[model samples]
Target: MRIARWTVTDLIHDGFVIDDRVVEFPDGLTVADVLARGLSATGELYERVRDAAATPLADIRLLAPLVPAAVRDFVAFEEHVEGVSAGVEGKSDVAPEWYEAPTFYFTNPHTILGPDEPVSPPVTERLDFELELAAVIGAAPGVGQANLTAGDAASVIFGYTIMNDWSARDLQGREMKVRLGPAKGKDFGMSLGPWIVTADELAPYLDADGFLAVRAEVYVNDELVGEDLVSNMGWPFPELVAYASRNSCVVPGDVLGSGTVGNGGCLGELWGRNGSLTPPPLQTGDIVRMVVEGVGELVGAVGAHVAAPQLPRARTRTRARRR
Candidate 1:
C-alpha cells in the first residue's frame, strides 16, 4: 500500500510499490482518488496492478506522491519549539496557548521540489535544512471540499512522506523581527517525496495503541547533521490538521507538514545562540539526504543556476485603452 506517482516510458501514472515490484494504478491517480473508492477498492487496485508485471523500481522516476491542491506546515513538535525557543530572544517554556491550539503556516504548493532535483539557494546565504513529515490528504467528505474535523483529517490522510523545509536563516530572522511568521525565508525551496507510504500499509509501524514511531534523521553530504524522535511532537498530526481545517477547508492531495523535527533539525535554530556553527552550506556538488523510519529517503544534489539575461523594463501605461 505504498502509493506513489512516477514516470516510466515518458508517461506518468499512479502506482503502488509491492516488494520490489512496480504496479500501475488508473490514470490521473491520486491518493484521494484511491481512498474514496474505500479499502476494498484499494486492495483490489493493488491486486490488479501487481498482477500485470513487475518492474524494477529504480527504472522509474518518482514524483511527489500527490499533486496537492494546497500545502501547510504546522509547528507541532515540542522539542523543536523548545530548542528554537531557547535560542530566541527571551522565550523558554512552551507557550500556554500552543498546548491548547495548533499553529501552521501556508506554504506555496508550487515551490515543492521532487526527489533528486537540484535546489538552488535563495538570495540569502544562510541556507539551512529542516527534517519533517508531511501528511498527504487522501479523500474525505466535506473536508476536501468544505468543512473538516480531526477524524476527517485522519480519513483524508492517504499516507505520509518525508519533508525538507529548506530555510534562509538570515531572511527568516529579518522577517520575523517584524513579528510575522516566515515568508521569503521559506517558500523558495522545499522538498518532499521519493514516494508516499499509505497509512494502512504503514500500520505495522504504527504502535499497538495506534501511534507512529518513526525516527527522523537528516544528512548533508553524507555527514549526519540532525536526529530526532517523531514522538517528541507536542501536538499530534491529526490535531494539527483538524485545527488547521476548523474554518478553512482542506482538500484531497493537500499536504500538511510537521514543521521541523527537534535538535539538529536546523543550523540556525541549533547554533544561532550557542555561538557555534554547522557544516558548510550545500554547494553545487553537495547532496542532501533525509530519512524517516517508515517512509523512504529523499536524495537531492545541489546544481548550478545559470543567470538569465536581463530584460528591458516596460514603460508604465496610464492612458485609458481605446475600444
Candidate 2:
C-alpha cells in the first residue's frame, strides 16, 4: 500500500494511494499511527480503507508522509563517498574505517518538507541535493528494543520513500574543519515523499542477495542529472538498520536514509569527476525531482537563499590555574 498525507481546502488528511486515487483513512488515523501498532497490522488497515471514497491525487496537496520521530542518514555508497570526498576535500580514496561498519549521522527531523514544497537554502553558494532512499521504521516487538540482528532489523522497516537531503556544501566544508559537524551544512532542510510504499509492495524488487534492486534517478529543472541502482550500495538497508540499533534503540517513525547514489546524484560528485563544477550548484527557482522505482517521486523547488547572520566570535581565555 502507498500511504500519504495531504491537504485539501485547508484540511489535512491521511490516506492510502491506489491507482491514481487516494482512499482516505478514518478521521484521526495516520501512517504514523498504523506504524506505531507495528507492520503486522497494515494488512487489516488496508482492508478497511481499500473500499472507501477516493480523491484524485491531483486535486490534493501532498505533505511529507509523516513527521519522523528521528532521522539518521548513512553514507552507504562507496562511490558517492569517494566522489564527494574528492570534490570537497581533494581526496578520492574511501576511508578504511568506512568499510568496517555502516556510519550515519543524525539530521534534523523538524524541518522536513513534502513534495512540491520550496526549499530555502541557507546562505550558501554550493546548494546541492542528495538522491537517497529512506526507510521508515515500524514498531518493534517491544519498546526500546536494542542490539537487533540484521534479520530482526529488516522486520522493523515499514516502508520506503524518496528523499532529497538538501545541502549547503560551502557551510559543510567549513564546519568539518573542526572535525565535528555537517550540522548547519545539512540541517537546513530535507525532502521526503509523494508517499510511502509499504515493504511488501517492494518485495518483488528485492534481489536474491537481499538488496533492493531498484533504479533511482534525479533531475534538476527537468534535466536528468544522475541515476543508479539501489543494489550498488556497499551495505544494504538491513545492515544499516542493524548498526543503528547497536547498543541503542530504534523506534517507530525513525527514518534511515540510504545516502547519496553515485554517477550524478549531486553536483559535488560531478565536480569530483570533472575537476570543476559543470552543471553548477542549485539556484532559486530550480526544481529537483527524484524517483525511486517501486517507491515514488519527490519534487522540491529551490527558493531564494536565506542569508545567515554572522556569529559573534568567542573570547579567548587562558585556562584556570591548576587547583
Q: Which candidate tops lDDT?
A: 2
Clashing pairs counted in every model: 3, 0
Error (Å) of candidate 2 at residue 217 is 0.5
Best candidate according to TM-score: 2
How high is the lDDT of residue 316 in model 1?
Answer: 92
Worst 10 residues of 2 by lDDT: 139-148
Deviation (Å) of 295 in candidate 1: 0.9
Computed on alpha carbons, the lDDT of every model, listed in order, comes to: 0.75, 0.90
Model 2 lDDT tens row, 97-120: 999998999999999999999998
lDDT comparing candidate 2 with the true structure: 0.90
Q: What are the per-residue Cα lDDT tens digits for candidate 1 across 33-116?
A: 875664456777876667776678878887767667788988877777766666565454578887777688888788788888
